[model samples]
Target: MPGDAARPHQASLPPAPRNGLVPSLERRRLQAYLLFVAMDGFILLASFSAIAAAYLGPGGDFAGVRQGAEPAFLLLPLFLTIALYNGTYSRAGLTDWRQAGAKAIAALAISAALLNFFAFFAKMNAEFSRVVFTAGIVLTGAVIVAMRRFLARRLTARWGRGAVNRLVIQAGGPKFSLPDSIHIDAREHGLRPDRADPASLNRLSQYLRNMDQIVVSSSRENRAAWAEVLKGTGLHGEVIDEATRAIGAVGVVKHDDIGMSSLLVSNGHLGLRARAMKRVFDLTISLAALIALSPVMMLTAAAIKLQDGGPIFFRQRRMGRGNGFFAIYKFRSMREDDSDGARSASRDDERITPVGRFIRRTSIDELPQLINVVKGDMSLVGPRPHALGSRAGEKLFWQVDRKYWQRHGLRPGITGLAQVRGFRGATDTEGDLSSRLDADLEYLNGWSLMRDVRILLRTVTVLVHERAF
Candidate 1:
């Protein structure tokens, strides 16, 4: 810890709800987002329909006009999906009309290319009216951009310039404030960064319930603890410490109005757009895998159940993204009575039942975790999460390296770069943990959608590794 100054402890008290004064705008924001999306879709459809009518109305066949406008119907969903991922409907877009319009146009262009690509492959390009589609796309882009600007103006008039709720906490530090943000003194609120105090943590959580962003201005001694506390909350957290550059701040936000800058310490590896893409990929893959492997999962469950009348699924709390704990699900591999939940299994462990032995080795025991992935607790590709009790040699995983906590900067995955690179199995030594940590950091540093696909493809080959025990 860089700054380790002690502060006087205040009597613990629960954080009072701020919703009464701040009337949570979450619902209103959602409604605005939906309105933006609907308006975009409507404009797109109208543009295509008008173009089609102008091009083919002389034929006097309403069916022909509808058929000519089919491209818009196909393009609508593609454009919306891309727009959603690109943040066209995000809070930033809502507040900044320029961002909304730019993203919307970019999404429409990509969608058009994709639609054309699909049509070419399917050999249906001849069926679509080129004149209608080309003109429709142009019109749609212009209309959507204008619509977004108009919507932003209307929303701003209604809700003010700050589209998202921001809260700033001054914790015994120089005053740092932002316009359109709620400011409160930490000491006055009886808030302290005490990891040992569950009541204090709960109060902090309550204070942050609906906030989109949280900024803490803490004295040098308390920066590290505040950073840790913010990490577990999974929110976009910043600490007003210029020294954070040494500890790997993702980015910095300067507030000229207050003559202060905050270090963004807890922003996740992916931005909102990248997160949207990753989440979509996670859902698609997990749902498809669950459907494809349902039979395998059922049979495995039956075998484990019939082995000795024990529980079929083994559930344990594992660290997730943002340092939060989640119950990871795995098919029970070891006998219920003799299982050592805290220790990693050795080769040919006697505690592993016959059925458990087969599934664990083949990685079939991990199938149930697809449910966890679908539930948004895990991903298809990321650093493998370790049990809290998991260790390398005699020391716990985090104890082996201080940077170990950073491995959890992203959501834990079913298969990671380390696993595909042969870093799987029980960590028998510190190097084993280090190798995986290094790989995890590498993955986080250079994350891309294509790299995730590559890791997943590579994972298939190592599913039945010898070290899985």
Candidate 2:
């Protein structure tokens, strides 16, 4: 609700041709995820049995074999974790067998390395069977990946024939060229995802009772307004664009809709592996920082209470990852009676008490944001959170650039490239926000753990500024 407009009224979409190959993969994605886990478990068990038989021989101790296979269960979690870690599982039905197997194999190699690393730490490497580790895991990974591919082909083909959800794309005008094959393919599968007119969206519910998806071409007018309107309809909305860079950053699958290669402009961000790694990083740092800095925080809390008996923490509704609104916390650096919580603080503001100025200057006021990182509302290093009334001059933040909101692709952070570049305070010029936007987009496109670490380390030296500090 902070600088954003109220949700638009629900509009009925125009009548659309409902023909798709299976419902949109969005609805059935979870079912396929579970299936892969099961298939992997089966394949791993079978491969282990074969390897065990050869290693133990036909007459070797039968009871020992059963107990021996018990340790192999550890490999199941490892397999699943590695599969998830590398995105072999999360990106289900989006890739072909070759790509899937390649990713799976890479995951297998990493899992093997992890197994050895843990084994070495536990001093179990000597007792662990090397032959089974190499041969059995290799065999298991091959069979599972191949089986995974076969199942993907089979399920997609099988489900493609059944009745599925309908997707209707509305282009601004009729001049856009769309392929008839798109309608034909959907018709063949009993789904009706065809091109429609954006003007008649007010009648969407009347024409298509079971419409599951509403897609908008990038060329559509007032995209934000239309998106908000459709949001009230309770159907998932996607903006399909031909721009590869914009699409690739947000889209998970490159869908050839009609005759055009369209990108699904949502579900973009750090993939499964990166998110998992970042979460681990967030927890490690947040918990450690909280423990190490408890005394400092306690003193700050007391100082604020004694200063004017005001609340120590200031919580504001700020935008987060996925364009979601969350309460961002900070040690209050303004007077408790300041009614304009949404406004940016001017240099030498009267609302800032003496203690507030020092904390803000030293960058200690933002330290409480570590709680946001641990709570998963933010990351340790990212685009800084902006208040609802956050603006560049008279215009609100999102209004400055069409792609500005894309900065929400990652969670907001306490400090970022923009801050280190000295663009942290009030933005009076358009160029100032653009400079910050450039840094944000740059961080997103080339994000890495090392880059995150470097940014975090770099943040310490630049936390204090002459003017703002």
Candidate 3:
């Protein structure tokens, strides 16, 4: 089983209907988003260049604005960051030309004000031509608005209001349907919400990979199970139930057209704007940390090789976002022959080499996971991922508490509230795991960028702990 290539539930989903329109549409929308960003950036640069050239006479050296052009680079990133949060390039913005235009203009205005404020405070306002820069901002706004209108018209002509892919599953509870949605009979597809079976979960994931929204119509007994399945998929999920309001549903979505209402159970932990911000933050921090710590990582790798001539990095499968599995990387610290990841290392373990012991003490062994963060398998701050065979005392992790599965609603992090609160080291007792799980769930309930920054800063204090071995 150690090297088994096949998963327990390895059957692929039935071939998609409509010639794979679901996946193709998903790809097109993503490409459109990227295209919008690229065009906006180009418009900004071109508008600024033209304005700068026209502002100065022909006899004037065009090379003089080189210093002035530096501001454009700074402004571009700032504007794009603001636009991301303002929904200028979001899915909704892409389909609605008027909304997109409004958001783009607002983001441009805010970015310009912020840039001017920073330039004034830093005593760099005189570094660029204010007249040309101001004119360029106005020109960029006009061009962006027109471009969005044209693109949105084209998209609407093809996909109409339902630009997203929606899936409706009938599972023997009630008859529910939506316009322009792909309807599937779960029985026909061999789909059932068997939470205990990885194969069942994988089959469900395949159907949900590109879906924007899903509505499941199932019997009362199966609604809860189906809800759990949907939560792990990280999509907008709902279940048909008229009594949902009385049972404390998160919210309700009423469909006036079909005269039916569903209980909105799960929408992941973050919205589109929040997810975009977190992703940008993760990439920026991970890339910078990788660059700054390259020398230390190199030395550690050399020492690892010089000690036992084993692999410098250890790779193991860990449960990631959506309860999926991804290979996690770590600096090898245990003896090569004794490197069984299914077993947890104990304090004062003889299997650890001298360099390994030192690196583990200083937490340098976790540096390799920065690569995981960059690969989108992990975040900079959230719940920490555990090995598949991890245990809390004599029982496996999930067996100890049913609520354990709920923690995967968000992406796992390199360092989280548990690690910052000194909850690191081995999990020898159930209480140790419970305390960390409590922290993890609390983090999921409430997440903010500021909280992540504070937790990261606090992690510095617990880098070296007695429990670490």
TM-score per candidate, in order? 0.72, 0.63, 0.71
lDDT of 1 by residue, 46-107 (tens): 99988999988676488988887899999999999999888888887877888889999999
Q: After superposition, how far is residue 285 of candidate 3 from its true place, in Å?
A: 2.2
In candidate 1 the C-alpha lDDT for residue 361 amounts to 92
Model 3, residue pairs in steric clash: none
For model 1, the superposed segments whose C-alpha errors exceed 4 Å read: 1-34, 37-91, 98-150, 157-160, 175-179, 182-211, 224-235, 243-245, 336-341
lDDT of 3 by residue, 338-457 (tens): 322556778878888899899999999999999999999899998998876677898777767756766887889989999998898888899889999999989988999999999999
Top-down lDDT ranking? 1, 3, 2
The number of residue pairs in model 2 that clash at the backbone is 16
What is candidate 2's TM-score against the reference?
Answer: 0.63
lDDT of 2 by residue, 354-435 (tens): 8899888888898899999888888898888776666687777767775665676677877788888777766877888899
TM-score of 1: 0.72
Candidate 2: misplaced stretches above 4 Å? Answer: 1-58, 61-90, 93-214, 217-219, 222-267, 336-342
- Score residue 12 of candidate 3 by CA lDDT: 53
